[model samples]
Target: MDATGDVILVQGGGSVAATRQTSRTMKRTANLQERLQEKSHAVGERADAVVAPLHGGAGGESELADKAGKSQMLEDASGNNVSLMRTMLRAMLHETSTQLMDEQKKMLERLWDALMGNQRMTTQMMGEQLEMVRQLQQEVQAVKTQAVEESRKVDELRRLHEQSTRQLRVMQEQTSEQIRTTREQTTEQLKIIREQTAQNFEQMRLQVMKEVGIV
Candidate 1:
């Protein structure tokens, strides 16, 4: 009876130790499960930071392409304006040259007309001077002919005066000869009458003395 009692007590103590060891093992397993859940949440936050930068870079590249297209269009418009200005300048130069040529031709025509008018005036003046000289020569010749006719009439009048003086001297000599012949005939008749008268006176004295006796 004493050994049997000792074996029963020993078996009961062994059973109690076994139950305490099982309870310690269950507590260690619950702590390990909580640490694994915290590690998973950290990995999800890192992935979100990487994806945001890639999305922003794609939008920036599209904006740069639009600005380059606008710059090319402005350069083409400026080149067309320069070409139009050059064409207008060339046309103005051609019109100015044409006007200058017309003015030069008109000046030459005026000079030619002036020369022809001067030549006609010189010819008319020469003809008038020649006619005046011819008239003066004709007047001088008529005056010389009148002077010669007056000289011939003076010589004929001198010859008629000399013939009249010779006729007057011959008439005076004939009258003197006729007066001497008449005086000689009258003296002979007076001498015969004186002798007859003396004889008659003597006869008359003798007769008267006989009658009266006193004679």
Candidate 2:
């Protein structure tokens, strides 16, 4: 028998080397067993051929022929029994080999399924991780945008405060200048009033002196 069929059956199914080795071993063993069986059968045939004619009795050739027939029948039965044993052993070996092959197939299937499941889970996890990273990036971008907006608002407020401060300084300076101008104007007006009052008093004195007839 060729082990190639068995080798092909196990190809790409996983455990190829072991299966091939086992197949070769099984083939060798089967061949050996078959050779042994053939040898046994040949020995039985030769023995029967040799022993069938040895029982000659006083009944002469008929008795001898009957004994030969009986021996032949016994040999045939023994051969049948041997053939049955070989068939049974072959069936047992076939069953065992089939069972082993089935187990290997099932194991390989389970491993494949597990590997696929793991790969799927790993891919899903990587996807989830990528999504999380994307979300994190978005969040970081949002935070940066918010920070920029806040910074811009702070800058606007600082500018406004500076402008207000400048306006306040300008107003204070203008108020001081206006107060100084008012003080100067009041002083000049008071000087003019004093001079006019003095002039009028002098004129009144002259008029009184002239009216007193000292002209």
Candidate 3:
């Protein structure tokens, strides 16, 4: 087919492959985001539990009250620290996930570009190959035509040769017959002349004998 059509097919196949890869990357990214969100939620819940006020120890119990007071102060300090840590952890997870997704995006883009380049190269190679095949086919066709024409010419020459050969044979037979007829005619004329000469000599001898003889 045409180069444009082949290029379209290559591009179509490349796009499909790239799309599948992109979809997988997107799925992985979504999964990672979901997991990080769950982790952050868990951390938030734990921090809230730490910061929540403790129950019990209501009035008239000075020992219990003093113990509760000290425990409360320590817990408040620890809870604040845990909360701060949780916030930092959340920020870090968000930033890390964002960076990871951005990197994945860049990688997919590069892959897509690479695939397109390869497809274009493939299309060009295929076009060249097809063109070569077409040229070869045309050459083969021309060769076949030339061979046929040559064969026809050869056949015509053979026919003419055979005809000429037959005509020569006929002429030879006619010349040989004419020579035989002429030879026979010349032989018959010579035999007739010899017979007439012999008769004439016999008459002359008879006349001379008659004239010399006495009665």
lDDT of 3 by residue, 1-215 (tens): 13223333444535654455445545655665676566666655654464444333344465466556656765765576567566755765565456545656766898999999999999999999999999999999999999999999999999999999999999999999998998898888888888888888877788888888831
Tens-digit lDDT string for candidate 1 (96-116): 334333433444555567767
- lDDT by residue (1-215, candidate 2, tens digit) is 34445544655555666475567567756875786678667766776676556555445776677667767766776677678777866775676577667867887898999999999999999999999999999999999999999999999999999999999999999999999999999999999998998999999888988999766
C-alpha lDDT values of all predictions: 0.46, 0.77, 0.68
Model 2, residue 111: C-alpha shift (Å): 1.1
Better of 2 and 3 by TM-score: 2
Candidate 3 Cα misplacement greater than 4 A, ranges: 1-70, 179-215
Candidate order (lDDT): 2, 3, 1
Error of 2 at 202 (Å): 3.9
Better model by lDDT: candidate 1 vs candidate 3: 3
User: How well does candidate 2 score on lDDT at residue 109?
Assistant: 91
Clashing pairs in 3: none
Give the top-scoring candidate (TM-score): 2
Ten-residue stretch with the least lDDT total in model 1: 1-10
